[model samples]
Target: MSLLRRWFDPIRSRWFFQKPTRQEVLPTEQGLSIYLRLDDVYSYLAVQQLPQLEEILTDDLKPLKVVISDTAAEPPNGMTKTEWHTYCLNDAKILATQHRFSYDEEKPEQPTQEALKQAETILKNTPLTGQNFLYLLEDVFHMLWQQQYGKLRTLFVMASQHQKPQETPERVFDHTPVLASYFEFGGRKYHAVDDLLRLTRRLKQQKLLTDNPIFLINHIEWREHLMSDAEELAEIQAMHPELDLYIALEDPISWLLLAYIKEELADYYNIQMNLYPLSYRSRDHFDWSLATRLSKRAEVEFTPFCRPTADSILEMAHLFYSVPDDEQVDAMYEILKAVWTKGKDFSFKSHFQQMQQLLSIEQLTDVNVAELLARNDALCDQKHQPDFPVLELRINGKHYVFNSLYRVWMIESIFSNVLEQLYKSENDAENNEFEISKE
Candidate 1:
């Protein structure tokens, strides 16, 4: 780890998360406050869930407030506004499908500026605090996502802006919207479904959740269900899905992901995972603090005993390549655990010897560590994403590169989609054959 990271990681992990935003530390009194804006797909998805959220919160946390931001955030770097908008729509569709939420599977029309103005006019006119806000907002989201512009236009015209509503809670949500939509409770923000579940779990700990067993829907169905028999497993294997998992020795998330993929995914599927060790800048998506939070959530042990040096990383890289492809998974796990958890610094000769003995590895005479790393780096360079734990998924004759460890779930999703396509194509062939026979 670099000197900056060494100092910064701990502080970020410790202080940054603990400090609440300037918003009201008033989960008890302020209830649940949601912030959203038009033309944001996640805002639409989040609005769908609020009616359920409003039902479950205690009387103290009743009345969900919707704070409409004037504008959506700029697209992430490297993407045009159109590209970002398209990506968000597609991404939101996936989330909608995953959560079984109400959504149009086809590309929905963007809300016209006039429609946005009308919706905003209705929302701002509606009481800024109460369940009524969520109901009206839900109607707006449904109309927007379902492409019911005519109904939205009628509602906009008929809806009463004449009812003046109190806006005392506006003082609490002063910050601009960064992501699509999020809930502010007790001065902290909880994002769409995943983080919303986290918030409810926190409430459950306080014995504040209703008797309703409000649990997050598990979106990723493990292959154990999809592959019912040897025949199905064979068919899935025929799809030729390949995962190129890139990890960094210094990154804690890389260690977490190696174990996750090996245990959660690799064991069940015939997919080949080509491991590479090329790391770049950390994306805002998953900082060390978030990784550590997920660590506790996953019940995985994550403790850094020593920061790796450049010399140590090179030595470890050579050691990594020395292991055969089949045994590399186990070897990688041991190497990471040793340096990260067991304090076996590979830079020291004694520690290096211990690890070599552990993996039963001999420094191969033909292995060129520098050449191998360069090759991997060059192959990975094709993916324009600059982040650690980069997953290059090649499946069903298509290539998809995801830049975060948070998205390991996509592997299973792709497999499911591919399986559906295979089944559909096979049925079509069988029908064609029968039609030819009949003729």
Candidate 2:
């Protein structure tokens, strides 16, 4: 077994939960309204769950009507899944249709030309804070009210993770005279699981509701349940033939449970996942399809990389090549373009040649491991100690010790910077010569 497989073997054992055998629609007594907020890990799952939830709500319960807040009306702060579910219930009472937000043309316009202009002026002049959420909420409510939708029975709001409930007595729950019964739904929280469960229980008890009807959709994380080595995930999979489960785990101590109740479950489930690290915000022209194809491969698995915004590819590029920021950005671009080139997959021998071509390394004479390590050591000595030591390179067949050719990656990046500087320097020289000749 490889290092990756050895690292992931324990994870496969711990996440051995049996998938539910039957397709379960959340059983609800009252009309059902689900508000699923998509965050990083669970966004894909939430999208998948939407069609099922929609079908059930429309075809089965057929509550008074389903209502969804327009994208603009998305809550400024996201609530707990419970809070969100309740919020949606509240919104549903006022608006009709649980589907995505759509315009109602039959309704008369509320603001006249003069009133609209005055409103815009007032909005521009007013200070904004928590009151902004309230203003947005009321704006939607008033619009629906004007159209004679009346307060709805069920409401669903999909808020961003950046937005959430705040601690302000006055600036809370924009809907005045909050709904009698509302259920908020959102993605899973690893750390806040107990808090979330407690909040759900408290809210349900407060409303005198039944058990387990409040749906909380979430993703698995590191440090969940642990399993003994005797228990393999495949053992659990064997028992649950009907259930569709997908698990994409990268850590042994804590597993990321990515159960996709859809196709491609077995392949992704209990597999060691890898995330690509890119420096600088270079995804604009990056080939997502290439990333996707690489991810599907059984050998040398790949997955979309997610690093925090500050440590993103863009930020990393900025960090690595800080001098002459414009040139740094150009170098970042060159690196990404090379990475995205279709034939640059690292699994095959031909791919390295393709990478070399993309990086313009084919023509360079003195690009190898020993030379590169010497250069790296000198740079490290100048900087202080040896933080950025020798470059680690993996070539097909055998290890070829050349200068920074081993540090081909770092070299390519530096070359990118050099290319940008050369362009700028040449341009500057041309302008200076033109001025002198004219004089």
Maximum-TM-score candidate = 1
* C-alpha lDDT of all candidate models, in order: 0.68, 0.29
How would you encode candidate 1's per-residue C-alpha lDDT over 1-439 as one tens digit per residue? Answer: 4556555554554464454422222356666677777777788888777777777777776555657676667665355677667767766676777667787887666778877777765665555455666677788888876878898877666555455434656423334745568877776777765577667766666666676645447544322344457776677777667788877676777887777677656656767778887533233243445566666555566654355666677778877888888877788888988865555556668778898889998664357776777777776655544346778888778877766554567777777777888889999999999999999
Residue 22 of model 1, lDDT score: 28
lDDT of 2 by residue, 1-439 (tens): 2345333533442342132312233343444332211111111122222333333233333321212211222331233444444433333221222222232324423223333333223222333333343344334334333442222111212221223433432222222222122233222221121133333443354443333433333312122222223333344333332211111111100011111111133232232221122222222332333333323321222232221222222322222233242233233334333322221222233533454454444343433423433443343333221111112222112221112111212222222333456568989999999999999
lDDT of 1: 0.68
Q: Using lDDT as the measure, which candidate wins?
A: 1
lDDT for residue 235 in candidate 1, whole number 0-100? 72
